[model samples]
Structures are given as structure tokens and as C-alpha cells.
Target chain A: DAGITQSPRHKVTETGTPVTLRCHQTENHRYMYWYRQDPGHGLRLIHYSYGVKDTDKGEVSDGYSVSRSKTEDFLLTLESATSSQTSVYFCATYRDPANTGELFFGEGSRLTVL
Target chain B: GESVGLHLPTLSVQEGDNSIINCAYSNSASDYFIWYKQESGKGPQFIIDIRSNMDKRQGQRVTVLLNKTVKHLSLQIAATQPGDSAVYFCAEIPSSGNTGKLIFGQGTTLQVKP
Candidate 1:
């Protein structure tokens, strides 16, 4: 297993509240990714970071923002939580930049918006 | 838009039988593919991966086959066991101009019945 860990394994928040999930990696991987998994939708990329300060939006980046201040920490923030945002979020890391290697994923964070 | 998809949403096989899961990707430029397994309440785990240059790769009790012409990928599990029951997903990385991002397909639930 990779040295990836996600904080707040389970969270329940009310609508309009701000929620932030943290992903920490000890492997010093170069690329880190945030994804959400829902029934019937598989896993959808939310955001990803290539370096300490480099980040990019994914296919489903709306309502979600990410920041990578250091090489080991990547944060995902939902400015305003919504019911539709309730899903299991996963953080993954890859050592290669060409995306040819296997991605190691953390356990997951289950967030519920009431 | 290019996407990856599975042929079936669910598959059931008796224990000790071989199991096969299929995936179809729309992007012809995709050269790297991976298969992941996710148990209940857990994040996806890397199972096997194959590069476009190869037609097949084998691991312990697992085989990954790639067909570049049809953009098809398959995973074969030998002697399926109860532990093999999980949701399987196929992910791909485009060959050209890829920024180390992975696109996932809808998952296939595998049930190994005893």
C-alpha cells in the first residue's frame, strides 16, 4: 500500500456549510489526484496537483477547489456543501508524470450533506 | 467527448470459475490502461495495468488484455474466490498531451458465489 492517508473518514454537514478534506502522502509522489465516487457514476475526477503549487481542474471541478501548498499535502474544499455533493471522495498518487504507472489510492472519505 | 465504459453493470460467477470483465474506451489515442478493484466502503485498489504496446500482461491469478484496434480492455480472474467479489473499474490515460490524468469508466460489480 502507498503511504497515503485521508482525514475525516466520515463527515456529515448541513447544506451551505464549508467542508474541507485533507489528503496526505508520505511517498513523495509527484502527482496527486482527488476523485469522487458515486453509485452509477463510477469515479469522477475533481481536481489534481502536479507539483507543490501547480494545480488543474478536472471534469467535475465545479463547486470544489483544491490547494497543494506542499509536496505531501493536498486539500479539497467545498465552499458551500450541497446534497448533490454527498459522495465518497478518494485521493490517489502516482509517481510518474506520463500517467503510465499505477495510482495508489487512500482509503476514502465519505461525506454526507444534509 | 471520449469516455470509458463497461459492457455489463454486474457479473455473477460461481466460486472456482473464471471471471471476465470487459471495458471499452472511446479514445483511440489512449495507450495506458489500468484495472482497479474496490470493496465495499473502501477506495479503489490497483489490480493490473497494461500498456498499449502490449497485447496482454499477466500477474498472480490476474490477466489484462488490451486491443488497440477496438479500444477494448479486459480483465480475467482465474479461479474466482469469494474475496474476488467487488466493483471493478477500468481507467485509461491518453497517449498524446496527457497531463498525468486518468479517466475512469463505470464499474462492473463482480459477485463470486459459493
Candidate 2:
């Protein structure tokens, strides 16, 4: 297991409310990513960071924002959550994105928007 | 539009039997592929990975095969056990050297019947 931890492992919130999930890693890796897992849709990337203050959008970045102010922490924010945004969120880190190394994943955060 | 997909959504196998999960990708430029297993209420765990330069790679009781000719990837588990029952996903990274963005395929749920 990797030294990754996700905060608020489970949460249920109302629609249109703001939600934020936090990912913390002690591995000192250079790459971090946010992904959402949904039934039949597999896992979709939301955002990723290569270093502190460096972030990029992914295939499913709509309606979601991420910030990486420090190398150890990455935050995913959903402004005005919707029912369609409910899914299990996973955080992962890698030493080198271009290398063949496997991404180490955290436990995951389960969010529900009703 | 390049995408990764699975041939079957569910696979059932008896304990001690062999199990195979198949994936296909449309991106011919994808050079790296990985197999991950996710149990209920947890994030995906890395199983094995193979690069386009190789035809097959094995790890423990798992094996990953990559066929660039057919744009197909497969994971084989020998002597499947109850602990091997999980949703397996195949992910690919393009060869264009992007920021490690991985495209994941629709998962195949492996059920091991004891």
C-alpha cells in the first residue's frame, strides 16, 4: 500500500452544495491525479498535477476544480455539486509520469449528492 | 476519438480455475498499459503492467499480454481464488509523452465461486 490518505472517506450532501475532497501523500512523488469512478463508465480523470501549483485538466474536468499548493496535498473541489457528480473519487501518485511505474492509489472518497 | 473498452462486463470462474479479462484500445499510439483490481469500497490496486515493446509480462499469478497488432490487452490469473474476485480495469498511456494521463476501460467484474 502507498502512503496515501484521502479525507472524508464518506459523505452525503444535498444538491447545489459545495464539496471538497482532499488527498495527502507522504511518498514525495512528483505527479498526483484525481479520478472519479462510476458504474459502466469506469474511471475518468478529473485533474492532475505534476508539481506544486501546476495542474492540468483531464477528460472529465467539467464542473470540477483542483488545487495543488504543496507537493504533499492535492484538493479536488466540486462547486455546487449535482446528482450527476456523485461517484467514488480516487487519488493517485506516481514518481514519474513518463516512466512505466505504477500509480499508487489511496483508499478513495465516496461522495453522494442528492 | 480514442477509447479503451472491455469485451465482457462480468466473468465468473470457479476457485482454482484460470480467469482471463480482455481489453481493447483504439489509440494505436498508446505505449504503456496497466491492469488494476478494485475490491468493494476500495480504490484500484495495481496488478501488472506491460509496455508496447513487450508481448507479455508476468507477475506472481498474474500475467499481462499486449498485442499492438490488434490493439488488445489481456490479463490472466492462474488458480483464481476468492481474494481475486474484484473489478478489473485496463488503463493506457499514450506514447505522445503527455503528463501521464491514463485512459481507463470499462471494468470487468471477476467473480470467483468457491
Candidate 3:
């Protein structure tokens, strides 16, 4: 039931440290995205990639960066983790032109910065 | 100013009842809309979707109603169950073909009580 898998399902790290979350997909989708969910706020897009090595910033990409070196893998990195950055992260993939961009999401990665 | 938003923050319904969730989008250029369900500690799952050309779409136990006239979208669930309790979100994709980006609504937390 898991076409996509997020590594380190749950992680806790100290503030100011660097953290990276990985999203891997078995489906060979063309578009991949990373989003973070927090209370009272909608899922904010962090970054997305249209193809290999093609990445773009989203609405809330100030402190985060992303890379899609391959078609099956997308990585999100926090340069300096902050407590305010703690939230549940999700990875999603979509087949655009065909399904009209119906996004299929992975389970999730819960990160806690202290 | 094409933002997707929900009308309510929370909705509580009795078991075996029908539940309705409403959303409003600001961009008429958006051609695709989708609904997602998220549990407490998990990622969001695709529920249903509707295209701009169509007004209604139905799935097994869920239906999506799109009103392009008013830029409103709604999700209807038949016989709401406890298992259906989760946060629901509505997302819209602009017709600009930026398949990598989706504007997500705030969210509505559904509570089904027996």
C-alpha cells in the first residue's frame, strides 16, 4: 500500500543542527513535491521538482532546500533546524497530463526540533 | 490571488449521517480540484477529484461537487463512519500547467461520533 516511502518516520534533533529527510517512490511519476503541515495552517509547499535536477521553491521555502537528483528520489534538507520548523512532512507524486495532476502522497515523516 | 480556502475549521457529525465539507477557491483559471483525507498521525490520502469542465464526480462512498461559477467546491460523504474522522483538505491546480504546484485549502477536521 506504499508506493512512496519516507525515511526516518519520526526524528528528533537539537536546534541549529542540520537535518535531512528523504522521500523515495516506486512509481515513476514526473512530478514530486514536499509539504509541511502544522496546526491552524494549511499544508505549505516547501519545494517541488518537475524532473531530475529540476527543483523550485514553494510558498514556505525560506529555511528549507530540496534536491531531486534522480527520478525516484527527492530530498529535503534543513540548513539549520529550528523549533518553529517542527512539523509533519509529506512527500507526494503526481502524473500530470494524464490524471490532470492527481497527487498521491506517502505516509509522512514527523520531525521534532528541540 | 488564486487561493484555496475552506469555510469551516471543524465539523462534527453523528455516525451513519451524511457529512458535507465546503471549500472556496479564488482562481477561475484553475482547472483541477482534489480532496484529501488525513488521519491524526498519517499523511493525506486522495479521496476524489473534479475537473473544471464537469460539475460533479462520484466515487464509491464520496462525491465532489464543483461550482466554477462561484469558485466553490464541496465534498459529500454518505453514511459517515468513525473511520472517516480525519482532517479534510481541498486543493486547486491552476491551468498554467504548473503541475508541480498545488494551492491547498486550510482544512476541516471531521469528527464522527457514535
TM-score of each: 0.96, 0.96, 0.95
Q: What tens digits encode model 3's per-residue C-alpha lDDT throughout B1-114?
A: 778899999999999999999999999988789998989888888888888899999998899999988989999999999999999999988897758477899899999999
Q: For candidate 2, what's the TM-score of chain A, rounded to 2 decimals?
A: 0.96
lDDT of each: 0.92, 0.91, 0.90
**Winner by DockQ between candidate 3 and candidate 2:** 2
Cα lDDT tens digits for candidate 3, A1-114:
439999989999999999999999988888999999888788989899999999999889999999998999999999999999999999999875565546888888999999
- Candidate 3: deviation at residue B73, Å? 0.7
Cα TM-score of candidate 1 = 0.96
lDDT of candidate 2 over A85-114, digit per residue (tens): 999999999876345737889999999999
Q: Docking quality tier of candidate 2?
A: medium
Total backbone clashes of model 3? 0
Clashes of each: 0, 0, 0
**Residue B15 Cα positional deviation in candidate 1, in Å, after optimal superposition:** 0.7
The predicted structure with the larger TM-score, 1 or 3, is: 1
Off by over 4 Å in 1: A97-99, B97-99
Q: Which tens-of-lDDT digit does each residue in A41-72 have in candidate 1? A: 89999999989999999999999999999999
